[model samples]
Target: MCSCQQHSTATSVATLAPNGAISFRVEDMTCGHCAGTIKQAIEGRIPGALVTADPASKLVNVQGSADFAAIKSAVVAAGYTPSAEPIG
Candidate 1:
């Protein structure tokens, strides 16, 4: 019997807003090191960017003027996949 759950928990979803806020999924972040890496990667790419990552929610919220492409790239560079939809 396959005991794996096919459902996605709150920690596996990310929400990005049109007001320069981004939220994405990250499953490997377990410590401060991961947070720092993610922040640095995003800030480095977005320049004056603000990011708040909730490991519990697996969501990374970013606020800045960076474009969606850049933001997506930053998230990928940080070792996470950016979701398709941008939350309002």
Candidate 2:
């Protein structure tokens, strides 16, 4: 007999938390390099931006004066799939 099971990927919609903080779910972030690249990409585009990425959870939190579109674009530019909706 064979048992079959399918793994489910968590679905997260990133929205503004507080004080201009946002979280994004990046699917391709699997290592520190990826995280660092993402951080740099975002900070480079948005000055005074703080980015924290968790490879284990595949989530990146950005806080400061940054536009959500740029943030998502930065993740894409850094080569990762990001899932989020900007809080306008």
Candidate 3:
């Protein structure tokens, strides 16, 4: 539903890799504005956190020394549902 008009078939669940990168699938993110808002929310809570949100993919990737709970909480605080992808 991204206003940017781009669409993607990325996975619809969040994942935390061994390297410490966290990936979240936010189905509600539907535009650059939404992405920005999500980014601000995460970055605001987790200092030095790097967030890359793609509305097209409804995916938000976070990198840095951050707690997974904190990251999810920030996103939830911003009013979005972030689903965690299972790690294999």
The best candidate by lDDT is 3
Q: In model 3, where do residues sit more than 4 Å from their true spots?
A: 1-12, 17-19, 85-88
Q: Is 2 or 3 the stronger prediction by TM-score? A: 3
| Clash totals in order | 1, 0, 2
Residues 1-73 of candidate 2 have per-residue lDDT tens digits of 0012222334457766666688777766777777788888899988888999887787888988557888888
Extract clashing residue pairs from model 1: 16-87
Q: Model 1, 1-88: lDDT tens per residue?
A: 0122232322344555656566666655545556667777888888788887765655667887537678767767776555655555
Candidate 1 deviant stretches above 4 angstroms: 1-13, 16-20
Q: After superposition, how far is residue 35 of candidate 1 from its true place, in Å?
A: 1.9
In candidate 2, which residue pairs get closer than 3 Å at backbone N, Cα or C atoms, i.e. clash?
A: none
Per-model TM-score versus the true fold: 0.64, 0.76, 0.76
Clashing pairs in 3: 2-30, 14-85
